[model samples]
Target: MSFRESVATATVSRSVHFFPLHLRRDLVRQAAEDLDRYHGKAAADYWRSTCRGLAADLTAKGCSDDEMREQIMDFQAAVQVALLEMHREQLAQG
Candidate 1:
């Protein structure tokens, strides 16, 4: 499936659901902005490492692969939306 399709169908993981909604939104927004600051391979590398780190962290906290998968998918969708909004705002300001 396409990234957009996957994102559109993404669900919040139970593990991540423990976090308050505001905190989750803040984390995703900050991560999205950080990822968007990079160019070319740097961006790809950052995203890969971020996902790996997230998986590792969740695993350490005793989360299952299914939970990790959902969290990752949810995170990806949130970041993509955040980045799109950022770009839209930038264009509007210019």
Candidate 2:
């Protein structure tokens, strides 16, 4: 599968609450980093596109802009935490 596809799959799978919190977070962070490495600016563009789609969909479903922004912020925060954890894991492993 493509990088985007893999990331989407990992995101969806983790969202179902099947994985442990740490593992899910690690997977997300790794997926994001791997995508960024492989696709560069395109990866960031994809993230923006996804966030925009998310906002638009939420708005269409009657969510307010503030709510949408908050949701996105929460997602970003989670990603940041996961990324940090991944970095730490790499350092420890090294």
Candidate 1 has its poorest 10 consecutive residues by lDDT at 13-22
Clashing pairs in 1: none
Residue-level lDDT for 81 in candidate 2: 71
Best by TM-score: 1
Give the per-residue lDDT digits (tens) of candidate 1, residues 1-94: 9987777667443334334222488788888899999989999999999888987887787777887787787788888989999999999999
lDDT of 1 at 13: 33
List RMSD in Å for every model shown: 13.4, 14.3
For candidate 2, what is the lDDT? 0.63
Cα RMSD, model 2: 14.3
TM accuracy, model 1:
0.74
TM-score of each: 0.74, 0.55
